[model samples]
Target: MLKEKGLFGNIGVQVVIAMCVGTLVGAMMGQSASMFAPLGSIFIHLIKMLVIPLVAVAIISGAAGLGSSQSAGKVGLSTLGFFGLTSAVAVALALFMGVVFQPGVGVDMTGVEGMFSNVYADKGEMPTFWATVLGMIPTNVFQSLNEANILQILVFCLFFGIAVSKLEKERRDPLINGVNAIVDAMVWMINVVMKVAPLGVFGLMADAVGTFGFSALMVVFKLFVVYVVAILIYGFIFYPAMIKAFSKTSPLKFLSAMKKPQAVALSTASSMATLPVTMEVCEEELGVKNSTASFVLPLGATINMSGNAIYYGLVAIFFAQMFNVELGMGAYIAIIVTSTLGAVGQAGVPGPSFLVVAVLLAAGIPIEGLPLLFALDRIFDMIRTALNITGDAACAVIVDNMINDGPQETPEPESSHHA
Candidate 1:
């Protein structure tokens, strides 16, 4: 019977059926359905465990490869330029979406202030953006590997790769080749692990549905609308226009190629896990150099979180309003700057955003309002991850174009025979 239906096809069919069954069971039994909840929670935890390592290894390896390429300088400049341009566009689209959709316009969050009391607080010691930059250099880079100090790891890898690039050809090629093989192996392992994704999704959904009950969907709806609008604006209007304005490639064509990776990102709700696919799409379909695309997209996964930044801005505003904490012009400016900088250093974990939100709340607003955000986080995360991957691809394409268009020095031919 299993062989009669294709494995993936059967799994997909099962998920649809399970969702329908879960919906019916939920509507009938309400929160009394306890069986699937624990199983689902475990599944979510397992997936979350993979995120930090996946990001650290992928970025370190990708950066090392990028640094080795002949066009390293051109690639680096283009990547930075692309990140700057796309990030600016993302912020603009987020602001526009907030105004146009007004997601928080009607939600009565009078009780939300009380919720913030349960949120975590930093004891007068949160690092400044510059301090955080310096902290990336771990006291012991190897010991801190699991903790995922990505910036430090990246810094170390960059210098190491550059040094390798300058080595004698015989020595350098073997080392680079070995590392490349390891990266390829890791990527292959991740793809294998992803085969169990439907089970994970089912587990997570079952748990959320069982515990939260149907009424929690109202919060989900609000976040869903905001997230969908934000993603559409960022992926469609913002990135496409930039591609057309900056690159030789057609924006529509580029977007079409990105669809598979975007879908994977949304499903996995992780930018890091989706990095390999993002790199592949950019290099193959978007015409980004493999070395450049590999490096920039991985780093972008770690640092260029435009979606999370938008979420930071919106959530800070939302919770403040919910708590009836009036912030003047000065406070809003502080939120924007701190949130944007903080997001770059954010870890790719399920609830990492909450920590940032908690910091903002601790600054003066109410942290208790975070429970409301938590209730809607999964829905929002799906969209946020998708938006993040889109920015990664856009950065790669623009960077590729810039490098190709830059000045070129023709190389002289070698003589057929030595004198």
Candidate 2:
């Protein structure tokens, strides 16, 4: 008999089954499925509750930690450069695929008209470049957090972290420890929240499938296919090639060892949750030194989001097509820039489906379309989280190579050393 993977061991399988069952019930029950919407809402609210504290603490701690070390500056610069380059590539690739596939070309918007009417009613024109730039700097940090203005929070945190990093060790240690404590608490809260994810996902899927039926999914089916294809290319082709080029480690072996963490990321749909496993795989299985893996992987989990960049680009273009919004070259350029920035700024924020609002605002796309995207966000989240962790591991390998002059030899087994 095949061994059962148990509840947590088979979470990905459970979620997939939940999605299918939700779709079936929704399709049969029609409008009645809307009742389950509250379950999803509560889940989203729980996620949102953790977002501000978690993001602020993670970013602040990560930035301050980097500033504390000497050679870390070099590592930080290298990591950022790698992240920027990879994110740019991911977004550009997404845009290319979106244009080629034209997934939103024939989507029927009649069903969602009522849902978005209020949003479109108050839709203002896109802000100018300078205005957008000025807006990122918060006039009142408290007000920014209250309003959940992520860009402003990001800006404030960057400066605050730098200031903290410059403080004397005696002063800095207390603050760092305090922030670390807060992060730990927030993560614990997230774990508590995630126990309800299957129910939440079921409700979300039920409502979406009931309201629009399979027809809505059909409209965006091409977009989904294109995204999956793009991610697979990144995961299987791009990552392996990058690893081979930068390090002497066998890409196949690296991927084999990464299976556990990747599974965790896929199931949990949270990079922060998968960080410990990623660190273990990088150090023990992939032969990276503790110093390099420790610094690079955690930072990558927070800011290096190749997957979100791609999703943002594709979603921006998809919505632009859906709404028949004509985007100029300037608008497309803005999409690339803002999407990249938003991915970094919005890291660790739950319910990222809505975080695309920042990109839409920048690209002049209607925020009204967000509700439509939110319906299918859970499905996309699983795939992107997997890609995100894959990118993190690839980065650790590359950074290790740069710092240590190619892959270090795997350490001798403990038992053999003792013998």
> How does each model score on lDDT?
0.63, 0.72
Output the number of the lDDT-best candidate.
2
- Give lDDT tens digits, candidate 2, residues 43-156: 667766766666667667656655565545667688889988898889898889888988778877766665463353243334556786898899999998898776677668
Residue 290 in model 1: shift from native, Å?
1.4
Q: Give the backbone clash total of model 2.
A: 0
In model 2, which runs have C-alpha deviations exceeding 4 angstroms? 1-10, 98-133, 247-305, 311-382, 385-389, 400-419
Structure candidate 2, residue pairs in collision: none
Q: Residue by residue across 155-182, what tens digits does model 1's lDDT show?
A: 6666666776566767766766666666
Q: Evaluate model 2: give its TM-score.
A: 0.71
